[model samples]
Target: MMKIRKLLDIRERSIRYGSVFRVLGKWPYEPLVDFLLVYSPGCDRKSNLVVSTGHKAGLIMERLPLESSLEHGANGISTKWAISNWDEWIYPDCPIEDVFVID
Candidate 1:
């Protein structure tokens, strides 16, 4: 089990589904603690079901049930996921703040 880090910031957009977050600490494979936590909002309300990283246009990686736990805060929920393969989990773009709203 990897040690979960505190969430430094969150990047949200008007899409109303997925959100990206930056953590304080780093993981095994990932040099940076940035992650894309995706979930269903309406009925499922499955938060942090899909954890991913890397550029949205380039190769993206993902993990299930984000293993690492996060520090509780008002900005957003704290959660973490283990490092997995560079699977096909494309998101909008990095520095999500530039493209998405910081919520």
Candidate 2:
């Protein structure tokens, strides 16, 4: 409980794709902490039919653990990695023209 909460508090958060989200950091990077596959994907890894949130994304990780992490980086997780993994899950990739709103 506290261990999880503590990670949330101290780490600059982003979406994850499984308990073992290769990508880490904030909008950029996060270091590995635990050895268990109990984490979820970041909320950003969604198009629809999903509750977009950091926790929900991470929670799903426990249900679907990936075999490996994303490509390692010091400047944060790669957007390419995020999108490719997301596409694997979403299938029939949904394309957008332009951003209507920025987060």
Winner by lDDT: 1
Lowest summed lDDT window (length 10), candidate 2:
94-103
Taking the tens digit of each residue's C-alpha lDDT, what string does model 1 give over 4-68? 22222222212123444443323342544445555434533334423344332222344333222
Report, for all candidates in order, the number of backbone clashes. Answer: 3, 13
TM-score of 1: 0.29
Q: Over 4 Å off in model 1, which ranges? A: 1-16, 40-45, 54-103
Q: Candidate 2 lDDT (Cα, whole model)? A: 0.28
In model 1, which residue pairs have backbone atoms overlapping below 3 Å? 66-80, 66-81, 67-81
Worst 10 residues of 1 by lDDT: 79-88
In lDDT terms, how accurate is model 1? 0.32
The lDDT for every candidate, in the order shown, is: 0.32, 0.28
